[model samples]
Target: MVSYQNNISSIDNNADADIPVAQYVRMSTEHQRYSTENQQLAIAEYAKRHGMRIVRTYADAGKSGLRIDGRQELQQLLEDVQKSDIEYRAILVYDVSRWGRFPDPDEAAMYEQTCKRNGIQVIYCAEQFSNDGSLQSTIIKNIKRSMAAEYSRELSVKVFAGQTTLIKKGYRQGGSPGYGLRRQLIDENHNIKGMLKRGEHKSIQTDRILLVPGPPEEIETVNFIYRLFLNDGMPERDIANLLNNQKIISETGRPWTRAVVHQILTNEKYIGNNVFNRVSFKLKMRLEKNDPSKWVRKDGAFEAIVPIETFRQVQAVIEKRSKHLDDSHMLEILKAILARHGALSAIIIDEEDDAPSSMTYRNRFGTLLRAYSLIGFHPRRDYAYLEINRTLRKRYPDLISEITSNIEKRGGWVTSNPDNGLFTVNGELTISLVIARCKLGQNGRNRWIIRLDSSLKPDMTIVVRMAICNSTIFDYYILPLTDFSPETLPFKEFNTFTLDVYRVDTLELFYQLTSREALQEVA
Candidate 1:
């Protein structure tokens, strides 16, 4: 448990009473003690005692403080502070932790400094420290930040341990139960509740989930896949092809793939063996597959969908296939494919029955590029894109910084998330910067293909087109999300009026769009 030093004191003497202030409150679902309403009550009381007027409020309900990625309200408060004619002179947060519990204490400090630099005072309404920049207050604030971060770290550990315990006790951990299984909810007394449908979860605290056989048709499909692999000696790709040919869709309502078939064949859950810790993606870090030795297993956790003996036979076959093809043998097959097809790709490799799967080659040789290099077959198109992509990656960060600086010059604040390069401008517009590489066509025409990341779902996308040899900028396209829906936008040297209208030599217009102008009233 984490504790806050709630020595709420009077507002600073240097500040004028009855000054306008903005109260910012945030609450994660982890605790009820720091709900937005509770924080607002504390902040309101502090404002009343200090003679400060609450002119505005920013609340992030059910939002985590670990990162500012989803907390739009706090982001707005930060952006609002940088405005020249900002209404609020001070920001009232319930406490330092409530402001943020960023893993890096420096990040919390950076935000506070951004507020200070813009002449906006951030007062922790519930903290004991006054945030006066005094030596004692600074030390206490730093300690509080560390404590908040440490509390998260501790909670993560406890949660992982609890989940692991639950897994060992034959209860289902996260993730879907696969194609032929359904999640069944049961009470603490082991009474059968109902089967949880897709996206449904148990609301009762004492309720637990267990994996059971799904629909009859899905179970038949699972058994059929196993029989094809074992009895008929069909490869995973062939099995997938046959399933797709029969118009049998997977759990995701999509055609079956070799990967999905392989998962169904190899996953031990079909044999009623519960496994955990096969992969770890703790604390929003990169996903990593753990070693077999580290995996926690509980056999016969659920009813067996396939016979354990048959499952082992299937595993043996897979293991033999993997171990049978050494590096030299895999390279020989790849070279044969390149010789026959005059080109190599994942699809081509998967299509070839004589050749090992592209994934097998990748696992053995780090990546398909390395395998291709070994086989002396390099796809010119892929190589060109790789070089251009590398160059674009190198130029991306500097360009983002330049855009951010330009926006600041026009009195607009930019808040960015390092995880993804999505940034919010003045808390009103979310923008994604894409650098389109120039490709020279056979007809001596330069073309730029902009691959917009619709997943980021930026309100506006700013595409920077490069000139010949990608040596310099050609022009810019500021496209709104509403207008552009396609994942890829191809542009020739000259385009139609609809697209060319967005083209500009400079972002002067864009900067102006974000600029906040002070209005003057004439009596």
Candidate 2:
């Protein structure tokens, strides 16, 4: 005989005895009838009739079942069952649709099989089958999974059609109002209402939304950007710099970027036009940008912030400058700039009024360096090194603070030298932090160059190799003084055995290396 403890009843071998089980529930926005509470109540009744006691519950509320990516509760339940010592003998779910509406029925079957392989049965309480591994039950489950996936497909098509109808009627479908526009709330009869603030939505179901001109400063800024591009002939980057230098913030309360400036210059909404379906992400698949021909447009949908003629002129100027420049012409301009400045870079190219923007050059030729090669100009120094150094200078203080905090948390002491910024850990070992910029070689492989600080030779050097974007660290290398030689180390892409022994993904290894240990002396 087996004794049970902690309110957990052991699984009875007798078919008549009660078995311990867990309940899983999920509810998406599509249906309130299959809500989490309703699913749980149905599962409770099913468990009582089947002589099974509910021991645990997992639920995901207001989550889509199209993909398992966002279902945290279901993920946790799977992880719990994967453990070797899980107590439950069975898992009860509301139905097949509540499990998932995965486009592939095999994906839903795989999840159910995983629970069965762990010596636990998965019972679809709301389904007609007994889930007893019979041919009839298997066929019904497969059919139900396919039906659930089809339901999502049909629903998506209907929702898109409804949004298109709204767009045709000059009602805003969704998304925040752009920089120089505010969303105006109105009743069904098209009566004047109040303006909606950021993140505020219409309270009544019958209300509609429309775009209206925003504040005077925002409207003036929009006009100024158009004039800067059209009349002054300033590029997007220059206009962004002008706005940022004046401490003017964008509608999103962030510093103006070149992309934001360009969007304002090109967007049709500024001229009282509504456009929809510029992109599509159907059935939770990859998002694809659609061609302009596929876009649905409604003219004079909102109040105009910029005149139509000025907007068209600006568009023509932008198109002539960007699209009309062939590769050879762009290269000739680059050569002229290189001849005058003795070097070429994105910033230098952007500063030139006669030349197209650096982004244009990049789009024409794969990269700036590639364009330089076409023009027969090889830079004497790697211009990227300067940018990488500047980024490192901005990041070093935060990295040092994090390291110091982690060391102190582990009961260890850290002191930094004011002269060279070398850290002495536990008053025993000195460490220097260095950043290595990642570069692509001619063979299309990743490489990192580590330039050691010989003048401030410490006990250990911590090297952070940046990723291709030069924004985040790819990997870390901790090298002791004795293991490193020479002033430079060039690393290739694949060096897992030798160089990878020193590579780590996080600072946790450093914490382990400097952890405090108690010592005892024996007589």
Candidate 3:
């Protein structure tokens, strides 16, 4: 057995002369959060100052703070103190709460009694107070502890509420800040007051640091990724592989993972929306699962890096196309079909003038400035094409060959001189024609033989042409052809509109009849 020190005579349970002293450090879930490390540091300093030999230390990363007995370290220490022949005489800690979070206050009282009754002294190196039969003072302390715990829970709620409000206001809790664009604190006027740049706090904004969306290079990367995935249907893993092979690093210069790719694909932040408390949990415990409903969602919260439709399209494709290597063939086939079908349902209203139209192939647009714009004063067809081919293929694969096959043109199917009823050469293929008059443009590009005004927009025309792009027994691939270039088809006021639809005895004729009757009435 170790001997007690003669110099420390205040407590009867002081350590014997030769045995090293032990420090008991614990962090209950309630206390182990952001400030636990500070507790450990203070206890170490206390042990050093007293010239005591530091024998051992016990720690719990994320146990509950409800009970003293709930703490393994406390139980072990109490058991050691109870042993008649144990050499340790003193137990040290940072505070009493570290002793227990919300145990039966009686347990705290009892643990203290056990130490006093036995030959062990309980010590709080920081509080420097005791539970030595001082019942009244201890009762008051316990009351305050209870209030503090309540306060902690209240504060947690308030913090979550505040974060949710921030996101709803278009502010995204910043994640790993991108290059050039570091996360910053701003005053009411959106001026940078403080910043986290390169994982370090800085006072001033340097030329190299950007407080905006991100560096141009990073923005370009984001755009590239959107195009590659949303626009092209590339799998998440494939996209990650592309980045890794190209030697591109994340915002922190680390290799990309499938999780990162998944996040990028799933992040609605690109669409000017914000998510709240993305990485928070029930406790600071590792491996803690969070409730999805608890996650916050806000719209119009930030500068949208991408359009909402583009973001939606990417999500839809991900949902439809499985991301497994074994399903690569099936994914590849679906993607090919999807690419041709285009994201027609994604509401792509924007288009690049000089470039090819985007995934949205079907659109409702009409112009009658050109001679062919209107078929003799008939109303123009303003149907947007959702180019729903894959849906058709998947929903009815047996009819793909017929739907994709072009219709054969029959000679003299119309009036003798062919003044009307001139269908596109391919008959089986579904096609629509908005019969509207075309007018001439003001200058070189807009000039048309049929119109006098050059600055005038295309006038409205009755859509009257119909051809079968695809057909089955009940359904047909019908696309209402909008005026591709209104400048070329100028219409005059004196013109008469005509619509012609070739309907067999049985096949689906809803579309054809709709066009024919609508045009005939206008003419």
RMSD of each: 13.5, 10.8, 31.8
Better of 1 and 2 by lDDT: 1
Sorted by TM-score (best first), the order is 1, 2, 3
By lDDT, who's the top model here? 1
Q: In candidate 2, what are the lDDT values of residues 94-158, reduced to their tens digit?
A: 88899999888999998888888887777777776656666876887799999999998999999
**Relative to the true structure, how large is the alpha-carbon lDDT of every model?**
0.82, 0.81, 0.47
lDDT of residue 434 for candidate 2: 83
For residues 84-184, write the lDDT of model 1, one tens digit per residue.
Answer: 99997788888888988888999999988988898887888777776777788899999999999988888789988988888889999878889999999
Worst 10 residues of 3 by lDDT: 494-503
**Model 2 CA lDDT for position 310:** 99
Q: Residue-wise lDDT of candidate 3 within 79-181, one digit each (tens)?
A: 6677787666566666666665442456565676787678666566655334343575467557745654555466667868876766676654546543324
Best by TM-score: 1
Compute the lDDT of residue 462 as modeled in candidate 1: 92
- The residue ranges of model 2 lying beyond 4 angstroms of the native Cα positions read 1-15, 191-193, 324-523
Off by over 4 Å in 1: 1-16, 324-337, 345-371, 383-523
Off by more than 4 A, model 3: 1-95, 98-119, 123-151, 172-174, 178-181, 201-211, 285-292, 321-523
